[model samples]
Target: MFLPDVHAEPDTEVLFQFIKENPLGLLITGINSTSVDFLQCTHAPFVLDLPNAGDNTTPRLRAHVAKQNPQVKAMIETLDTKPSETITLDQEVLVLFNGRHDHYVTPKFYTETKPDTGKVVPTWNYSAVQIYGKLSLYYDSKTPETGAFLGKQMHDLSEQCERSVMGFTGDGDRPQPWKVSDAPERYVELLQRNVVGIEIEIRKVEGKFKMSQEMRPGDREGVVKGVSRALTQVGVTCMGIHLYVPRQ
Candidate 1:
């Protein structure tokens, strides 16, 4: 995450939009002690609780993981020392969301398009966001609260994904989107036993958008058209080709 000042993206709106579009984030956890090299990483779909633009409240990431996951066991082990603490707020973790589209840029694209510009070189165009926060695990291995918490995560996650694609219409003619409540109550109860809920309260978020903004004017436009054409050929919708130039 070595973000140069030129590459840094401070736009909060763009950052959240990127996260919503790419909800599947990689979660990395490390122990509190400096001597420990133990690190746990998991990939899960996260639902963001992003407050209003001017609001000062911290954002949170909500998601769940399988109960059998080793990271779950690792967190439980780490929290054993503080039995009274239901939520482990002291442990910071990292969550990463990769951009939806990324492509390599060849100097040939620039050289051929702009024959006079020999200054162009190869580069990569991509977008990425890194979130740092304290992870709060919400499952008491022995209590009913565990099932309830896990169930809520499942329900919310399902609805989020469904709504993004196509929400339930309640019409008999069209096939209804699947929901957590659609499953049998007993089956859901049993299903919840196999997973646990987690939430990360975000302390910091950073976005890096490298889309040839630093290149010469001719070279920059060449990249956009070249990348767009290449993406269309492969049947992929181009996501972000950021060309925002920061004021000097």
Candidate 2:
């Protein structure tokens, strides 16, 4: 939650694009203020309802969790307090998405600038985005509105994951993307009974990319080489990666 200005990214479209690439998010909820379960975190892959590049409308996040998941209970309880005249901060939830290209920087990587001062230390280089929002839950596909909402979420989420994560094009020579309609209506209905749909009206979003850019050019190159060499040994490619400290 602490974001330093030098590390902060003011361009939201860039941040949203990062989420589109890395759609799995860690959902955070602070439920009962005085209870042990106050801080709740859940991990799930979500599809974003991002608006056009220049639109002023707020974006949203859509995902579903198992009906029996403990986090569901927490979210349901939070939504129940909307009638209160004074809205509390606990009602807002956070979804954190981290970029894929991240690595650790060791003092050893400071080949060019180190060995002179012997003052370098180890730090992590990573990129992350935090999104805060008020979430609404849909319990079932029983009503017209609820049915449409649940159905669209399932279908769209499936297609998006297929196209984005699975590399299915749903056209051309690539493999065809799958959709919720691929299954029997009754089967889909049966599955829906065991889960709850979640929609978050995003209130705020912030991205931090801490990649050791603050260091000298020589040190930055050293980090890239160190990470790339380490990853190459493990059959991974980590050529260029950057992350930032928290902002002001």
Q: Write candidate 2's Cα lDDT for 128-159 as tens digits.
A: 99999988777756656556777888988888
- Candidate 1, residues 36-62: lDDT per residue as tens digits? 447878999999998887998889999
- The numbered model that scores best in lDDT is 2
Give candidate 1 regions above 4 Å deviation: 32-37, 52-56, 81-85, 111-114, 141-145, 166-175, 235-248
Assess candidate 1 and give its TM-score to the true structure: 0.83
Q: Give per-residue lDDT, candidate 2, residue 105.
A: 83
lDDT of each candidate versus the true structure: 0.78, 0.79
